[model samples]
Target: MSAPEDRPLLRVVKGAPDDYQLAALTAVIAGLASVSPAEDKAARRSEWANPARRVRRPLQHGPGAWRASGFPG
Candidate 1:
């Protein structure tokens, strides 16, 4: 079997690329390799869909009860 170092990093199947073109291609490939992948962020849960929201708040008695009911706990 051929050694790892013996294998070419890239190969030209058809068209012949100049030194500058090959250099640009190599730089692009190297840049892509160096970039870190974006983090897998956890999706935010909507407040409206929360289980706590589904549960009813305790009933308040007396003055301003109507106004309080309009507002969130």
Candidate 2:
């Protein structure tokens, strides 16, 4: 017989053993709370803001030597 390979994935097992997941979530929440509110707000804002300082390499084609800028590859 073929192995069971068609089972669907479950985001959360209902009424099942979920203590680990709950523990992990609690840990994450605790960690987040450990940070200062101002610092946390700044970090969250930065996460959405465009990154600063990027590498620019001159392209060998196009009208002028175009350059690409952004986080390092």
Candidate 3:
């Protein structure tokens, strides 16, 4: 008997899928498997909730300090 690691990644139990259909299914599964949990969480994270936003920018101490403060870094 073949080991689990040597088994096929997918099996078509019901219908016979065409080459294109099988390729699409394989691509989708491979794409999903490539993304790590950390990357998935980062992708779902909101820009507003970013930790970088919490960190203050360096204070510009020049003539345009006040004006610069009004604009983002």
Candidate 4:
């Protein structure tokens, strides 16, 4: 059998949606979009709060370690 080709779309209506419809739509929207800016910032901060998970760890420059690692001292 052939696959379906039409994409689903949302239509504007004059009246507001019912409680159930609103909840379902909210869930769907939440699933599609990312968290709020504040929440995202908090998440990033939490990640960086842990030293092991940090993007830049303390560099160990023993003698010429920096030059050996291809980084200018």
Off by over 4 Å in 2: 1-17, 37-73
Compose the digit string of candidate 1's lDDT tens values, residues 1-73.
9999999998888999999999999999999999999999999999988988777889788999999999988
TM-scores vs. true structure, each candidate: 0.60, 0.28, 0.46, 0.27
| Best model per TM-score | 1
lDDT of residue 69 for candidate 2: 29
Residue pairs whose backbone atoms clash in candidate 2: none
Worst 10 residues of 1 by lDDT: 52-61
Clashing pairs in 1: none
> Which candidate, 1 or 2, has the higher lDDT?
1
Candidate 4, 1-73: lDDT as tens digits:
5445554455436788888987798789877777555543443456547876645545766897776666523
Residue-wise lDDT of candidate 2 within 1-73, one digit each (tens)? 6566765323455665578977786788778879776643443454435464343454355544344223333
Candidate 4 global TM-score: 0.27
The lowest-lDDT stretch of 10 consecutive residues in candidate 3 is 36-45
- lDDT per residue, candidate 3, 1-73, as tens digits? 9999999989999999999999999999999999877643445778898998889988899898999998987
Q: Which stretches in model 3 have alpha-carbon errors above 4 Å?
A: 38-73
